[model samples]
Target: MMTDLVLIEQFDSRTAAEVARSILEANDIPVTFEADDAGEMIPHLAPVRLMVGSADEAEAREILSEAMKSTDEAGEEGVDGEPTA
Candidate 1:
């Protein structure tokens, strides 16, 4: 049977996409990634899409949002008295 997958976010880098996938998976939410070019032939043309089932979309989004918020807060901290741009 086919599952209804919902697009959560798109990433320019595979590492970022995989990290999101890992976060969702750790929470018991199934996730998958789709990309046009697997070999990174054209960096600008490639986009890694993170997808989750429609049923888990809300929870997955919440988890990612929290993670992003934390990341943003961490970035806001000044490094050596200089704030990160």
Candidate 2:
């Protein structure tokens, strides 16, 4: 059986998209990446897209949101190698 997929997000690089794919997969959510990089010759014209089944859209977003929030909090704690007050 095939499922309908919905676009969840787009990343400028394949590495970023792969990271997101790993996260979703770890949580039991299936994901696929789409890109049109023209064989790595026109990276600027290609954006990696993260997609998940329509039925999993909301749960996927929630998981991604929490993960991104945690990442943001960690990055915000220090600025240019200096601790923030």
Candidate 3:
């Protein structure tokens, strides 16, 4: 399908992709999942991808950015110097 906008987010795991998808849906944007065929043998292919249309590109990027920022912050140590990781 031809899209006016397409953004790619690489997730460390499939669950992360799903979470991202849900976030987009919750915000009223349409999302489509793309993945290498399970039956295919492409080792270099990503297992899952969350796709947002061109119209929602900006909002999608914001949502993804926020998710990544929160994830990064969660990995940092608190003011007391206790590492969350």
Candidate 4:
């Protein structure tokens, strides 16, 4: 595994970030998150940083974009019912 981690996305809530992480992992991409809450909180008050290997940055972004778009199409936004546009 490459140690060069790169921040690919920042989500307002832990649920959003976890969803993104699941999307990435489902595609066989390794990811890491940086947050103060240790993935226990459900608030959108703080941002969560989603990261992947530098070599996987482009792929990770594309996957996340598609995931978010699909969620938009499904009439859901940001995992907590917040508007995404």
Best by TM-score: 2
RMSD of 1: 2.3
Model 2 Cα displacement at 18 (Å)? 0.5
TM-score of candidate 3 on Cα atoms, chains taken together: 0.69
Task: Tell me which of candidates 1 and 3 scores higher on lDDT.
Answer: 1
Which of the two candidates, 1 or 4, achieves a greater lDDT against the reference?
1
**For model 1, the run of ten residues with the poorest summed lDDT:** 37-46
- Per-candidate TM-score against the hidden true structure: 0.84, 0.85, 0.69, 0.75
**Candidate 4 TM-score over all chains jointly:** 0.75
Once fitted onto the true fold, the runs of candidate 1 whose alpha carbons sit more than 4 angstroms away are 79-85
RMSD of 3: 3.8
Rank the candidate models, highest TM-score first.
2, 1, 4, 3
Q: Which pairs clash in model 1?
A: none
RMSD to true structure for each model, in Å: 2.3, 2.6, 3.8, 5.7
Clashes of each: 0, 0, 1, 0
> How close to the true structure is residue 13 of candidate 1, measured as C-alpha lDDT?
83
Candidate 3 stretches greater than 4 Å from native: 1-5, 39-47, 78-81
Error of 1 at 61 (Å): 0.5
lDDT of 3: 0.74
lDDT for model 1 comes to 0.87
Worst 10 residues of 3 by lDDT: 37-46
Task: Rank candidates, lDDT, best first.
Answer: 2, 1, 4, 3
